[model samples]
Target: MKNISRSTALFERAKQFIPGGVNSPVRAFKAVGGNPLFIKKAKGAYLYDEDGNEYVDLINSWGPMILGHAYPAVEEAVREALSCSPSFGAPTAREVEMAELICSMIPSVEKVRMVNSGTEATMSAIRVARGFTGRDKIIKMEGCYHGHGDSFLISAGSGALTFGYPDSPGVTKGTALDTLTVPFNDLNAVELLVEKNAGQIAALILEPVVGNMGCVPPAEGYLEGLRKICSKSGIVLIFDEVMTGFRLSQGGAQQLYNVKPDLTTLGKIIGGGLPVGAYGGKREIMDSVSPAGPIYQAGTLSGNPMAMAAGLAMLKHLKDNPGIYDALNGTANFIIQGLQKQISKYRLSCSINHVGSMFTLFFTDKKVIDFASAKTSDTVLFGKYFQAMLSRGVYLAPSQYEALFLSAAIDKTIADRIIQASNESLEEITK
Candidate 1:
């Protein structure tokens, strides 16, 4: 067994200052039933914990470190930028360059605004949509997480087309009243809601390919259906591509699927592992934000030079070398196939959902299309599997609800190791 004395000590010390001894709730390991390991550093698909245990990272900072952790190019760029000071809180040439690159790469984004987090990007995009459409209500799919925004912390109430109820304590009924939800991949339900609400809906937003509810991909004609519905209803179509952006494809799912959104909210890979986000779309709609028009969203550190440099380096590498996507997807397939063999070998009641490098191994025999079906997974079994994998030196997402992110750094050798470890893990768990 790996020693965790330092990690345990740090956790005990951290809890006194930070809530649950971690910044993110999932990192607490309440779901997996263990004290979370304190990571000392990470580099290229590996996490070194304070306890001296090295883990093969499968989450990749929840889908950011696409090329790999501490990529040399990004590292050097950040270092050079830091020499110019950390935060200017003022416009820099890098921000303009970053904006230009994003607008050039993403088909839907004619104009863009930088923010600090995915939450800010999504919330701002919705606000822009509302402003553009002169409407108050918005529609989001069930089980899709856009972040912890007030309007996003919602759950489906009893009836179809009924306004969502606040899923958290702090969100008010008034905020929830303007937000509506229906099952993901259910086109008829969205159509029904649109018909019921009629002309009142400002936007229809979704994760084009969901990563939040365990990497659920859109059903056949699902994204196309949403685009048609929104176009017909004059509602802004916002693709919250925070997870899928850059990870799924160069232009994200929109480009891969040949569908264009009115707005796209981006984070994760865009910052090259730093805290950054962006929302962009059509010219007329984007022009409505800030000095260009009425809708107001500002940030002190929206275009920090350090973040821009890192993002630029990462994006440039991606744009210059398109083969990275194929490599990432190929590596993911290798790992998934290995896991598949183990499942068949053990005759396990499990199914895996995957899209490119993002995937989830659900401990259920049933297919997962939406949040409700995803919930059918046996959390107890998943917790067991997670612990089993962790003990074998592979680090997975703590919760079954989240997806496992594979980076480009997970090469053939690493993939083989993951496969071997998984096979042994399955044997141990089944025994």
Candidate 2:
């Protein structure tokens, strides 16, 4: 068995220094009720934890390590970039190169802006949209997380058609008032809300394939219908592709679904597992951002050289080797099918949703099509399953709300191991 005593000791010491003994809230394992594993290092599909136990990793750093951990190309690029400097706080040639690469790959983008996180990208895009359209209200689907921005911490109001309110404490009522919440895939609900707001609506922002509430995909023609409605009402359409960009396809969900948006926010994969975010769209709209237009947004470490080098390396490689997606999706399909077979054999109450390389297994018999349905998943069963899998050296996302990411590193051998572990874990938890 893996010796977790060292990890427990570290967590005990860390709680005195770091809040919840983790830099991120989820890392504390609050939802699963356990101390988080302290990973010493990772290579390819395996994670060597503090206790010297290795696990076949399935989370893939929340969907960034498509090429897998510590990829040689990405590592070398970061090392080369560090030889020059870290940040310039001024324009650099590399920045222009990155922007050009993104614009070239993404059909809707004529201009782009770099930011530090997904939250900044979405927040900045909304501001620009409001400024250009002269509108104050923005619509977002319920349970869709757009980072911790004050305006996005909203819940659906009492009525199915009402506006949003603060779902978390510390979010002011005024901030919540300007944000409207709607159920994903319900195009008629959005149409009615847009008709009611008319000229006051700024934009309709959503994850084209909802990952925050598990891998709930868009309904047939749902995106096309939303686009038509946005066009008719003159409301900006924003696809929060932060999770699906690059991972879904080289062109992201926009290409996968054949529905374009006015703005796209990207993160995770673009940074090559680093902290970076970007937003891009039509030149006219992007030109409205500071130095070129009225909406102001700036960052000192906007294009940190190390992050740029790593991202450029990863993007360049992926752009050149389009077959990476095929490999990743193939492995994903293999695992999904194996798990489905196991679930059927065990007669477990579960729902599995997969798209390309991202998937989620929900502990419910009903399909999780939206936030309300996603809430019905059994967390207690998931917690037991998580421990079972962890004990057997198969690492998955610690939370049910997150997606299980696949990478090129997971071969047939690793897939078999995962499948076997999952089978045993299901049996252990269900009993």
Candidate 3:
């Protein structure tokens, strides 16, 4: 077995200080039955753990390292920005440039606001929607995570789902009352909610292509149907594209699916793997934010120069080479196809939900189109598969509810290796 002694030691040391031995709940590997591997460094498509073991990274920093870790352009940009100073706590030319680039690329965003993380972006977006519409209630899809904001904890996904506390305790009963939820891809449910809530609902937010619930794509015409519903009901349509933005397409899932949302929250690739996020939409709606309107939201490090520089470099590269999307999707398809062959060969009860470069190998025969269906997965078997894959140098997301992201750095040879690892891992786990 690959030595994970160092990781074990680190976890032991960390638990005395950090909560649950990791900064993030999912990183504790509680669901997968092991201590987490502390990453030493990452480059291209591989992660080197503290144990001196190498892994073909399938998580890609949870969907940020699209061009792969430590990419030359992103690194160069950050280095140059670092020399100037890390933070000014004031606006800079880079932030303006970043905003212009985002507005230009994303079809719905005529104006934008930068934040430190996806949670901040989503929280701010919802507030802005409420202010603009003069309404109190909002609708979120079940299992579609919009960060750790108090209003979004009900029926949430991602780490919340993995920990078996979708409705987090800290969230007030009042917050829960305002947040309405329905299963994803169910248009009729959404319509019914809209009718019942009527003018009280301010926004309808969702992940146009959900990465939280293992990469579930929208049902055919689902986006269009929601768009129609929101427009008719005078409810703000917010697409929490924090995971799908830039990764799925130049304009994100909205552009890919040919539907536009009033507000879009973005993170991950836009920050070039750094901790940054943004929310934006139509000019009138964005004008409702502070300094222009009344709704207040501020952050000292909202547009840190380093983040802006790194994001600008990453976004510019993507804009210039649009073919990267095609390459990433192609690689993902190859890997998924190989895994499917293994499932067939072993007669494994597994199903995969894929969109663009994000996917999940669910340990279930049932199609995973919604949270309830996703839960039908055999978590115990997934834990075994995860351990098996880790042993074979293929690092997957520790939680069964999480999706695996592919990067441009993974070539055909690496893809073949991952497939081979999956085949061996499956055999070993089943035995």
Among the numbered candidates, top TM-score falls to 3
lDDT of 1 by residue, 203-236 (tens): 9999999887788999999999999999999999
Candidate 3 per-residue C-alpha lDDT over 230-306 given as tens digits, one digit per residue, 9 for 90 to 100: 99999999999999999999999999999999999999988898899999999999998999999999999999999
Candidate 2 lDDT over 163-213, as tens digits, reads: 123286788888889999898888889989998888999999999998877
Backbone collision count in every prediction?
A: 0, 0, 0
Of the candidates numbered 1 and 3, which has the greater lDDT value? 3
Better of 2 and 3 by lDDT: 3
TM-score of each: 0.97, 0.96, 0.99
Q: After superposition, how far is residue 80 of candidate 1 from its true place, in Å?
A: 0.3
C-alpha lDDT of candidate 2 relative to the true structure? 0.86
Sliding window of 10 residues with minimal summed lDDT for model 1: 157-166
After superposing candidate 3, which stretches have Cα over 4 Å from the reference? none
**Which residue pairs in candidate 1 have backbone atoms (N, alpha carbon, C) closer than 3 angstroms, thus clashing?**
none
- Candidate 3's TM-score: 0.99
* Candidate 2 clashing pairs, residues 3+ apart or interchain: none
Each model's lDDT comes to 0.89, 0.86, 0.94
